[model samples]
Structures are given as C-alpha cells and as structure tokens.
Target chain A: MENVRVIARMDIKGPNLVKGIHLEGLRVLGKPEDFARYYYENGADELFYQDVVASLYERNSLHDIVSRTAKDSFIPLTVGGGIRSIDDIREVLRAGADKVCINTAAIRNPEFIRDAANKFGSSTIVVAIEAIRQPDGKYMAFVDNGREHTGVEVISWARRVEELGAGEIVITSVDREGTGKGYDIALTRSIARAVGVPVIAHGGPGKKEHFTDVLLEGKADAIAVASMIHYDLIAQQQSDMENRSEGNVSFLKSGRSSFGEIAPAGLIAIKQYLKESNIPCRN
Target chain B: MSGKKIAIIDYKLGNLFSVRQACVYLGYDAVVTSEKDEVMKADFAILPGVGAFGDAMNNLEKLDLISPIKDYIRAGRPFMGVCLGLQLLFTESDEFGSHKGLNLIEGTVKKFPPKKTNDEVLKVPQIEWNNIWERADRRWESTPLGSCRSGDYMYFVHSFFVQPQSPDVVLSVTTYGETTYCSSVLQGNLFACQFHPEKSGHHGVGIYKNWLTNYSNNK
Candidate 1:
C-alpha cells in the first residue's frame, strides 16, 4: 500500500508569511523561510508556497526565499502563482523548487502545460485546480486565487490537464479555504477519481479526523495543512523561547495555545492518529 | 578521477540540482557534467535523468555520451542511476515508442498493467509514496537500499517500469496492482533505482551515505 504525503501550504506576501480568508484580506505571519524550515524539519512530506500577490504584481518574488530554504531543506518544494511562461517555470526550478504548480498561467495558456511538461518532464509540473461550486450544479476552475472563473468544470478540467501532461493535480476548494470546517470531501473525491495523476487535497481542515477522511474517503494521495498548524505552532514555539529569556511578548502570543503546543507538534499527533487508523504515513 | 568527487551525468533531461544538493547535504562533493571524459574519469558517476526513454537516449547520442558512459561502466567504477537514468541502462524501452538503450544490462522497460486482477484501476505515472521491499537475498545487503527494510515509503513518479531479464540482477521489488516489478538492481559495480532516492527525505539521504561509505577506491 502507498503512504499518504502530508504537505504544509504556506501563503507568502512580500517577505512575510500571510493568512487570509479564502485567499483574501492578507495578514503577515512571519518569514516564509522561517515557516518553511519549521514545517520541513517537523514532518512535512513536502512544502507548497504560493505568493498571494505574485499574479497581482506580475512577478514571482519568492525566488530568494525558495533558494535559501532549498539549501536548508531536503524535502520536495513546490512553488505556484504568477507563473506565466515556461521561462518563469525554469526560473522557479533554478531557484531550487523541485516542482512548479501553476493556476492562472495554465488556464490562460493550456498549451503551456504540454510545453512545460515536454521541456521539464511531467514530474516537475503540477496543475493547481482552484475549484468553487456554483448555482449551475457544478464546480468550476477558478484562477488568480479564486478571483477569476475559467468556466471549466472541475472534473473535466482535471482530465484535460492530465491529458495535456500535468504530472500532478492540486485540487483546492475556494469555498473551504481558511474556514477550517473540514475538507470539501465531495470535491476532492470527484477530482481524485477523475485524474490518473496524484491529487493533493487542500483548504479547510479544522480537525484531526479530516486528514483520515480526505485520504481514505476522499481518496487523496496527499493533504495540505495550513491555518490549523502555522500560527498555533509558530506562536507556541515563540512564546516558549520568549518566556524563557525575557518573560514576555512574542509574535504568536495572540494564538492563545502558545508556550503549550507548537505547530510541528500537531504533525506528530496527526501522523500518529493516521497510523493508528491504519493509514500508512512516512516513517 | 583521483578525487572523491561524484559526477552527476546530465543529458539535458534530468533534475541535476536536487540530486547534487542531496549529495552536498550529505557532505559529498558532487558535480553535474555531460562531458565524456569527466564522467568516465570521476571516482563515482551518478546517472540522474528524467523524461522519456527515447528522448534521453537520443540526447545521449547527440552529446556523444553513449560510448563514454559504456566505457566508464566497463572500467568497473562505482555507478548509480536514478529514475530514467536507471531505465536507460537496459537494452530497450517501449515508452511512447520502441527505443534502444545502452544495453549495459539485460532488460526491457514496459508500462504498468492498466488494471489490477480484481478489476481495481492501477494508476499510470504512479505519483505517490510507495514502500520498496527488498528482494530476499544477500546481494541487496550491499546496495544503497541496504539500510531500508520492507515497508519503508519512498517517493515514486513514473508511467513505465523496467523489467530485467534475470531475477539475479533484481535487488528490490515494489508492488503496483497485482504485479510486482523490479524496482532496484545491483550488478556488481552497476547500481540503479526506479525511484528518486534523493527526494525520499532521511531514508533517501541515508542511501547516498550508505553507498558512499562503502564505495572503495580499489579500481
């Protein structure tokens, strides 16, 4: 049996790690590398960094951060957003990202997927499907972080991209983003079933059981965790270190659980829960 | 040739940096080169490749690397291959179309069975974390996977898998669908794995360490 990969999805805005409701209202968390290093060292099978403003600004600015993190981390790194051309993909890869995930550029130029896959190999390319449900009774692929509607149904788009040579498909739920209610299991299940490539389920996981459900019931090859782990863990670690030296203020102090349980700590907990539930995780 | 440098062969179709960085992470001095002399002369040569078999073989020919690589292997130096690099060691591959390989080992690569025996779908380009169990034997005890026992997960992404002629050369096997195919092989100084050990986290880096630690300069 294959083991499920656990990924940490971190949003980057300028130099700080940011969090927003459904990819909106950006708020800086900390340094991108700081969160990336913490996640990789803890048990993150892979890391997903999407620059929230990359497409808006028309430039992928996470190059330096990716290069620095690549030197320190050994796990697979994926960079997405604002990548408009094959040259942009090369630049990201040269910056030490193992794989490039594209959304807007891919929808704008579907042929770009085949071209990139042909040039860089399928494994280096990932098609990120930002899906949101509509009144027409179908999930449509959204671009620019759920800002633009491509009008392509999620399942059919997934199949089309796979045929076009996408090595993997990342299915993110716009409706579930940052809500922490649980995964959009129905959405994940459909796309996972539709595509031959591995599907990574992203957005909305507030509980430990969601990981098991999305993997087993939804049949996702990997699950990306964000809101739940990022702030809590970083704050907790910061509080511990701060309370140790100065006995006061910390960056993650408002996170409440600081000085108690760190972010990476949840990784071990969820991993253990998954194992106990008979789900094979990387040992 | 004299130094402890590890040469990573680049034929314009592989992730050379990540592999080199893995070795560098383990404190091994690694270099990426497509030059015939440098590759043949390195203390240890790591043939790391990605993409289709036909394209890779064609690129090797264009670079005039076919003979140099064969000559290097014949010299009995330690050589290890990753992914497509491993497949190119075979006599032939049926990916996209029939293609000729380096014929360093006796084998032909084939696509995975589209469906399992029980009617369950077997995904092509298996892009997931899979456990490569060691084939029961003593030969595997010497390869990079020596540290890994059965059921330890490693990352794998491929549409086709290599099938060797003789089971004697097979070092490890991974089950996909109802069939079990040869995943890793060890033929004296020649070693290769279907999965990317460089991206398999600690277990992956440990493989490089094991192979390097035991690799000698006798030749």
Candidate 2:
C-alpha cells in the first residue's frame, strides 16, 4: 500500500540496546547489531537509531552502527541524537544514513530546519517531537531527553516543522513508552490530522495488534516500535518438529535394563526433518 | 550547442551534489556554482533548493547574483527551479510572516490550512509520490515532460504552495489531502517544479535528461 511504511527504532544508551519507561529509566536488553539485523530480515521498511546519551559525550557511536548496517541491509536508515548543528547532520548523512532527525537543535534554531532541508533536500530531514502529557491533559513537547518542557503544543509544532521544510515528523509519546500497554492513539491521530506531511508514530507499541491499531485507527502513516521485538516477547512463532519425534522407543532386548528416549535420535534425524519440512531451524 | 554547459546555482543551500549527479547520470556535464559569470555564461541554468522561500531569496540577494540571473533568464536561457527554488519565483511567501520572494513570477506562496477534525486530516508539507497532470498547451506537450501522462506520480515535499496570477503559466497539477495544487509551471524559458525530480529516482532522471536534451537542442 502507498500509505503503509514500517520503521524499526533502535534506542541505544551506550553500546547496548535499551528499553525505557516514559523516556526516563532505561533497561539494557541486548546488542544493537543483532536487533538491527533481526528487524532488517523481518520485513522492516526502515530503521532509526537514537542515542540516549548525554550531550557531553562528544561522540555518537550510532553513526558507525548505522553505517555498518546500511552496508549489509538494503533499506533506509535514520539517526537522531545530539544533532545540534548542520555539521553534525552532515556527519551522520555521510556515514550512510538516508535521513537525519533533529529535535532540540531545531527548536533552539528554527532556521536550522530550513537550512538543512535546503542543503539536503526535504526528503532527508526529519523533525522528532517528544510529547509528554501535561496536567491539563494536553500534550506538551519536551526537549533534551524529555527533561525540559516547551509550551508549544504537539500539533502546532508538527505544523511548524513542516512549514520550515521538514520532510517528515516523528511523534514519540513519552508517557506511553516501554509500558507495553499500547501507543497513544489520540496523540498520534491528532498530529497526523494536523500536518499534510507524513507522520511516524513512536513509543508504547507492545504487540502486532498495537501496530495495526495505530495505523488503522490513529491514521499514522508509519509506526516505530522497539521493546517488544527486542525482548522476543512478540513475533511469529514456527513449529519445526514432525510426526517422527512424537513417540519414544524402548531397547530392552540387548540390555538387562530397559532404556527409553525420544524416537528421533541424533543430529541427522533433526536435520533430515528440518530439510524435508523446509522450516528454518538453527542451533 | 553540442558542448553547452549547464550551471546549477549553489548558494550553500540546496542539494547541489544530487543535482550535479543527476546531470552527470544523464550524460551532461553540469557544475554547481554561485559565481555570476559561470551562471550567466551557461547555456542553461538550474536553481534548486529545499528550504524556506524567504531564506533562499536572501541568499540570492546576498551573493549579488540576482540581477545577473534575471538578465540571463531574460536573454532566453533555459532556467528551472526545484521545490524552494520553485517557491522563490513567487512574489511573496507567508512563512513565519509575509516575506518577499524573487518576484520573477507573479504569484504568492501560502501555507496549507490546518485540517479540521471532521476533515480527512491532511498533513502539512504534503509529502509522498503523487501523480502529475500535464498542461494541455502544445508547447509544454512538446518537451520531455510531454511524455508524462495526466497521472504520473512524482515526489513532493512542501507545506506552502504558489498561486500564479496567470493560469497560462501552469504546466502541471497534483492532488494532496483535500486540495489539488499546482506542481509545475513554465513561462518563456523558465520552468519550476514543486517536486524534487532529482530525488524521485528514475522518473526524476528522465525529466533531467529531457530538459538537457531540449535545452541543448534549442540553444
């Protein structure tokens, strides 16, 4: 379908892939390269890398990771985090990322969005909005890892970003992150309704159902998910055992004591079964 | 005419490399330049960018190449603008506030209105690949763009649009959200596209090839 685009997000907090709750506390899950390959092989349309490190790090390791993945994977990739200048954006793009997502830098200097878009073309510039629920039940934008709040409303910012030449806006819900509950459908729908540009909804997607819900109900053009897939709690399950392994055999004629075991013996039986069934089973 | 050069105006904004790369892929020797002499001396010129209308106009003015560019186009040299370059041809743009454009074309740039709840919720900066409808004019029909049918999909990425004072200038149209917008327009030797043909892959390359072929032959 023309409107369906799936993006897999890899949130990093050092060298490890991390999942967090409401964009605050994070838990390391596994290596990012493994997860990136898994997503790439499993029908992900695009991939995104966001380094959650402090701005003082002076270096972003995500660029190398994205570059390495792009070399092997045939899909578009985007990198975001600590992108404060045009030079930073250029560095990431040069490293083989198809697009660069800017947030705090864009808010601090609105003109930067226009400049980057002009230099790289709108297709390569993405505006990421971290939205948190406010006291009055309205969603407010947060910058700098969701530490500082901006009075700018989510929908308004989405509109402004597009006007400034941002080709796409990735709206992430800080409140629903890592909860495995589901995406904030209302927020995603509102932002999707606000802009004529494509909107990518991120955060709080726990299962395949959540993805369907957001795309069908929330009207999000694309949905970015990380946690559930990283933990292996969700994915398609396949069975490889055949009828030959259903029974056990007892050898009592040669031995004084009866010995029993699962019928299909050794690696040969398993390999033959797998080969005949044409199921992908790895050890 | 066989060895004519095409200059792509690069003012520290716009995808100069991609434009140059596209030209190279189409078997044309194109250079990205901000120099007036080079731009004016070229057989054809291309003004390509993806930014706010106001900032682009400012850069053109700052470089002191505006008058020279106008003179070159007036001399009947083929000129084309992509995205913001297309918007730059308008008289004014209402981004952040009302800002003046190059006034090369009689038109105004305005943002897409906010989508109401009951509406289909058209996103701003209408993006994605959409169909392009060709103009009925035989002159436009004779160019490489003439090969495109009424519903050929080209890539688009913009929120604001230009409304030409004269309908005779419009060469193509595209639909977005709830509105049907102008996608391309041409007047004399000048042509502007709201979509990025350079990034549109094969179709984009075809457009560039057609332009180069036509420009070289006409010269």
Candidate 3:
C-alpha cells in the first residue's frame, strides 16, 4: 500500500504564522520558522509554507524560511503563494525547496506549467487550486486565496494542469478552510478521481477520522492541515494546561520543548489512529 | 566525508540543490557544478536529473558536460545517476520521441505501460513512498541502499523505468500494479536508481552516507 503523506501547512504573513476561516480574519500565532520546526520535529511527513500575502503583494517572501527549513529539516519542503515566474521557481528551488506550488501564476498562463515542468521537472511543480462550491452545487476554482473566482470548474482545471505537466494537484476547499469542520470530501474526490497526478487534500480536517475519510474514501494521496494541528495545539494548551495547578499539564514530557513550546501529541495520535484503520504512514 | 568532494552535476534540469544539501549534511564537500574541471576534479560525481530524457540530453549537450560526464564514468570513479539522470545513462530512451543518451549503461529507458490491479488503475508517475526490494543475485550490501531492508520505502516520482539489457546489472526491483521493472542498477562504480533518496526520509540520507563510505578518495 502506498503511504499517505501528512503535511503541515503553515500560512505565513510576513514572518508570523497565521490562520483564518475561509481565508479571512487572519490571526498571527508565532514565527513561521518556529511553527515549521515544531511540525518538522513531530511526525509531519512534509512542511508546506505559503505566504498569505504573496499573491496579494505579488512577491515571494518565504525564501529565508524555506532555506532555513530546507537546510535543517530532512523532510520535503514545499513553498507556495507568490511564485509568479520561472525565475521565482528557480529561486525557491535553489534556496532548497523540494517543490513549488503555483496557483495564480499557473492559472494566468497555463503554458507556464509546461515550461516550469520542462525546466525543472513535473515532480517539482505542484498546481494548487482553491475550490469553492457554487450555489448550483458545482465547484469553481478560486485563486488569490479564494478572493476571486476563476469560473473554471475544479475538476477540469485539475485535469488541465496534469495535461500541462503538473506533477501533483493540491485542492483546498474554500468553504471548509479553517472552519474546524471536516474536509469537503466530495470536491476533493472529484478532482482526485479526474486527475492522474497525485492529489493533496487541504483546507479542512479537524479530526483524525477526517484524515482517514479523505484518504480512504476521498482517495487523496496526501492531506495538508493547518488549523487542525496548529489551532488544536494552541487551544489545548491555553484551555486545558495553562491555568492548571502544580504537577499537572507540564509541557516537558519529552524534555525536548524549548521555551515551553512543544509540538502536541495530536499529529502522532492521528498517524497512529490512521495506521490502526489500515492506512500506511511513515510515522 | 569532510574532505571527499562529491560534485552533483547541475544541468539546470532538476532538484540539484536538494541533492547537494543531502551530501553537505553528511559532512561531505558536496558541490553542484556544470564546469568540466570541477566535475573531473571531484572524488565522486552525482548526476541528478528529472523531466524528459531528450530535454536532459539537450541540456547536457548545451552545457558541454557530455564528454566530461562520460569521461568521469569511463575513468571508473564512483558516479551515481538519479531519476532522469539514470534514464539519460541508457543507450537511448523512447520517451516523447527517440533520443540518444550517454550510453554508459546497456539499457533503454521506457515508459510504464498502463497497468491495473484489483479493479483499480495504477497511476503513472508513481508519486509516493513505495517499497523496493534488493535483488538476491547481487546483494546491494556494497551499495548505498545496503542497509535498506527488503521492503524499505523510498520516495519515487517517475513515469518511466529502465529496462537493462542484462538483469545482472540490476541491484534492486519494485512492483507497480502487475508490472515489475528495474528500479535500481549498479554496474561497478556507476550506480543509479529511479527513486530520490534526498526525499526518502532518514534512510535516504543514510543511503548517501553509505555511498560516501564505499568510496575512498577522501581517505
């Protein structure tokens, strides 16, 4: 059985890691590097860093963060959000990212996917699509972090990217993003079933069953989570452990936490539970 | 490891930086270069490439690295070819169209035929971490994947696999659906695999370490 990749998606706003519902009302958690390190040290299979403002500002600001993580962590790193050109892709790859995820740039110029794939390789070029369900029950692909609709249906765009030479498709449901609700399995499955390349399900998954469901039933090759792990850890810490009395809820069980910051047991637990459900994982 | 210089051939076609970074982490003086002198001067040369075989061949020719790479391998110094690097080492490849390769290895690169198993179609460009087993005839014990158990999962992302003229050169094999093809091959100092060790987690770095230990220029 092929192993399902579990990736930690850290949305970066400048240097801070942030998350929001439906890509609005951003809240800063901490530095991108710290959160990246936390996920890397834990059982996360990969780290995906996307600059929330990259598309809006039209510039990539995650180079330093990608370089640091690439040099330090052994897991594969994917940097996305503002990549607009072949030179930008080269810059990120040379800086040490294993892959680059392109959304707006690729949608603007479909041939860019072929050019980048020809220059670098399809395996390193991932086409990211943000899909929001329409009132007619169809999924339309959105770009610029779900701010604008592209009018192209999600499934067709996924197939087009693969035909244009994208190695993978990362589909994020705009409706379920950062909502702590389960993933939009139908939308993910439709794209996954249509495209031949590996599909990464994102923008949902608040619980372990969500991972199993999307992977097994939805048939996604990987799952990218932000709020599920990041916010869950923050919520668990602040609500349950912060105000507890002595001899309770200490963060040093692993003795590896620095500055009282430690990766929660959530990811590992999800991995274990997934494996128990017969899904193979590296962890 | 510190003194041994491992030059990763950067033909502007693949993830050259990550390959070099893997070597640097193991304390190897790993450098990515296209200069003939730098490639010839290195203790070991790693040819890492991805994408089409014809495009890669064109890049090698454009960069004037063809002679130096062929000469490096002819000299019998330890050399390794990654994915498209491995494909480009064959006699020729039938990808997209007929294209000649470096012809160091006696094989032809081929695209995986559409395969199916248990009513589910297997996808091309098998992009995942799947198990690859070492062949018993020539144990990979002397190779980079030596410590890799029978079913050690390595990161693979490719649509084609090599079809060696002689199975004796094959170091390992992997199965995809109902098809089984050559995954990794070793002919003397020239070692090549279809997978990316740089993306294969810890065992991947360990493979790089093992390869460094097998070579002796630094010592």
Candidate 4:
C-alpha cells in the first residue's frame, strides 16, 4: 500500500477562505495564503484550493492566490472549481498549480475530461466528484459545490472519469462534508475500488482517528481535510486573528471551535498519531 | 553567485513556472524558451514536461528543438529532464501508441502494471510521495541526488516509467505496489528522473543546486 497523502483543502470565496457545512452557509476563515503557508510549513503533504463560487460568478479568482502560495510553498498545489475549458486549465497551471480539478464542467460535458486530459497529461487533470447520499442509500453526484444535482451515480462516474483519462479522482461526500463525524467509508471504498487511479477522500474529517479510519477502512490513497486543520490553526492563534479585516470573522471571534462537537487537532499531531498506528505518511 | 545560464525547455506541453521558480530560488537566472540558440548557449539546460509522450514529441519537433537538444547533450553540457521530459529522451514510449523519442538514451518507456504480483490492483500514475533508494553501486555522492539520502521521499505523478537498456545508467530505483523500476538515471553530463524535483521541497532544490554547483563549471 502507498503512503496516505494528507492534503489541506482550502475553500475560497472571493479573497477570503471560507468553511461551511454540506458545502453551504459559507463562513469566512481568513486569508487562504496565510493558512496555506502555515500548512505547508507545518507538514501538509499537498494544498488544494477550490473556488467555491466560481461557477456562480463565472470566473476563478484563485490564480493570484495560487501564485502567491506557490512562491513559498514548494509542495504540490491543486486548484479546483470553475475550470470549464482548456484555456482555464492552462491559466491555472501557468499560475503555478500543478493540477486542476474540474467538477461542474466535467459533470456537464463528460468529454471535457477527455479533452483536458489529452491536452494536459492525465496527471495534470483531476476529476472532482461531489456526491450526496440519496434516501435509498444510493450515492448521487452533484455539481456547483453540491448546490445542484447531476443525477449521476458516484461509482459509475468514478469509473467513467478514470476511463476518460483522469489520473486521479477526488470524491467529496457532500453529506459528510463539514459534519466532522468521519468519512463515508462506503462511498470512498466504492470509488477507490471502482477506479485504478488513486482516489482522494474529501470531507467529514474531524479528529486524528477519523483520518486513520478513512485511510484504513475507506481505502483512500489520500485524504483532503478542511475544517479539522483550519479550525486548529485558528485556535492556536485566536488572539492574533481576531482583528483581521477580511471575510466574516464571526466564527473566529466566537472562540467556539469544534468540528462536530470534537475539538480539532493540529496537522503535526495527527501525523504523529498516524505514525504510531503504523500508517505510512510523510512528515 | 554561480552565474550559470539556465534554460528550461518550453515545448508548450507542461508547466514551466515551478521549474523556473525552483531555479530562481536557487539564485540562478533561468530562461524558459523554445529558441534553439538560447538552449545551446545555456550552461545548464533543463527539459521539464508533464503530458503524453506522443504529444510532447510532436511539440518538440514542431518547435524544431530536436537537433539542438541532441546537440546540447552531445556537447556534454549539464542537462536535466523531469517527468515526461525524462521519458522523451528515450527510444520510444508505449503511451497512447508506439511513438519515437529523442533516443538520447537507449531505453523505452512503458506503463505500470495494472495488477501487482500478489494479485492486488495497482494504481496507475502513482501520485503520492514515495521514497527512492540508491541502486547503481550505491553511488550518489557525485550525482545531483547526492543531497538526498536513501529512502528520501519525492513527489511522483506519472503512469509510465522508463526502462533503460544499460543497467549501469540507473541511478535510483523506486518500488510502487509490487513492481520496482528505474526512477532516475545518470550518464555523463545528463541526469533525468521520473519524479518532479521542483515540487519535492527543499532537498529537491538541493538537487538543482548540487547539479549547478558541481557540473555548471565543469563544462
């Protein structure tokens, strides 16, 4: 088995970093660049920047953020959201992103994945599947940050993306996202087993044990974490970040930080716990 | 203070920013270009790419960079290739279909196996950070990878790997799933790796610095 990659996922809305439950009700965190540099220095294996409202705005404002983050952070950077055409992919790559993830565009026209993969190697293209569990226990894919339904099944979509030449897949469970209970193991394992490419499990990570569970039981090659690490960073310097002049800082000001009733742990501590459990991960 | 000219080859198939930024971070002025003259004049020329093998060859040929690159290497200038750039120097690749390469190195690029020997399904395009161990005589003290110790993890994102015909050229080997293949090679003034050193962090930068510090003035 390969070492599980722990990626710090930052959801961006305009210039401020935001977080929400089920990918809705956005709450401003802080400058993503600050959190990105912190994560890179602290031991984030990779950085994932997703423009949450890019599809709604019809433009991606992550190019500046991506370039600034890439300047100091030398790790792999992946940017997602609002990537609709080849030019959009090229612009992000030129802005210092190593990979571009397509969600809405990929769901709208599946062939776009093939074209993007063909133009920019499969390794450069990542198909992000936003999935929500249906009432009948079937996982259905969603688009636009889980704001719209695609009526596409998650497992079959994973297989199709891999077949279309996607080098990697990021299957984010909308229902589990931001809830911090744990990952949807069934969703992760199903997609992981459905595709030969590496699968990155996103959302629903609250504590250190949750990461262990997702990697061991979910069979995810990598895990994309947000609130868990984000809240931890904010908690460490709550005093310093209180006066920041960007985004809505009400969540930070409240000083009541918890991911689904459990306090979040720092990334370093999480990696230490993973190592003690015999799970391979880069320090 | 090395003052060595660095040219990152731009075949229009991959991101040249990270490679150039890595070079700039090392205090060397790097130029990303397709002009043959710029490439030939550079003290250190780098071929960095991330795309299919067939498309890369087409772009290189379209830009008329084939002869100059071959000449640059023939002149014994210090050269480095990353990811698809490393694969492009081989004889041919099995990606997409049969496609000829620069043939600068006697090798063929092949895809990773779909399944391991233990009947476990293997993931293509290993995208995780995996460690590399010294293979050829355990001699890394003089190569660009000298700064990195054995078992140092580097960022890898590719499905196909190169198989050099000459075993002596193999500098390092990495095992993914059940298969172990050549991860990097060093021959004369040329060094290439399947992993992206620019994205590999500080030790990776140390690689470019070592190559520049040691081989830059040798030419």
lDDT of 2 by residue, A46-152 (tens): 67888887343646777667666655554457888888888888888767676889888888888999988877778789999999988898999988778878778
Model 3 chain A lowest lDDT segment of ten: A254-263
**Rank by lDDT (best first):** 4, 1, 3, 2
Backbone clash pairs in model 3 (N, Cα, C under 3 Å; residues 3+ apart or in different chains), count: 0
Q: Per-residue lDDT for B12-129 in model 3, tens only?
A: 7777888888898988898888898999999989999887788789889999999999888988899998888888889998898899999998889887775465666566777777
Residues A1-283 of candidate 1: C-alpha lDDT, one tens digit per residue: 4568888899998888987777787767778898888877778888889998899879889999999988868788999978989889889988899899988888888999999999999989999999998987689999888988887898999999999999999999988887777789999999988877789999888778888889988989899988777766765677677768765654456655432222233676778888999998775
In the range A100-136, model 4's lDDT, one tens digit per residue, is 9999999889999999988888888889999999999
Candidate 4 residue-wise lDDT at B112: 88
| lDDT tens readout by residue for model 3, A1-110 | 46778889999989888888888878777677877777777778888998888999887888888888888677778899889898999899888898999999988999
Tell me the spans in candidate 1 whose CA falls farther than 4 Å from its real position.
Answer: A242-251, A257-265, B1-3, B217-219
- Candidate 2 per-residue lDDT, tens place, B1-219, comes to 246688999876644555666676566678889999999888779998766666777888899878988898788878998888888888899987889888889989988875744655565656555677875653446665755667765666678888999988888887665667788988888888998776554566678778777767665
List iRMS (one decimal) for every candidate: 1.8, 8.6, 1.8, 1.0
Candidate 2 clash pair list: A118-B14, A195-B123, A195-B124, A196-B123, A196-B124, A197-B123, A197-B124, B125-B158
Cα displacement (Å) at residue A157, model 4: 1.4
lDDT agreement of model 1 with the native:
0.84
Q: Is the docking of candidate 4 incorrect, acceptable, medium or high quality?
A: medium
lDDT of 1 by residue, B82-144 (tens): 999899999999998799999999989999877776765666778767778875664456567
Stronger candidate by DockQ (1 vs 4) = 4
Compute the lDDT of residue A84 as modeled in candidate 2: 81
RMSD of each: 2.6, 11.4, 4.2, 2.7
**Largest TM-score belongs to which candidate?**
4
Better of 2 and 4 by lDDT: 4
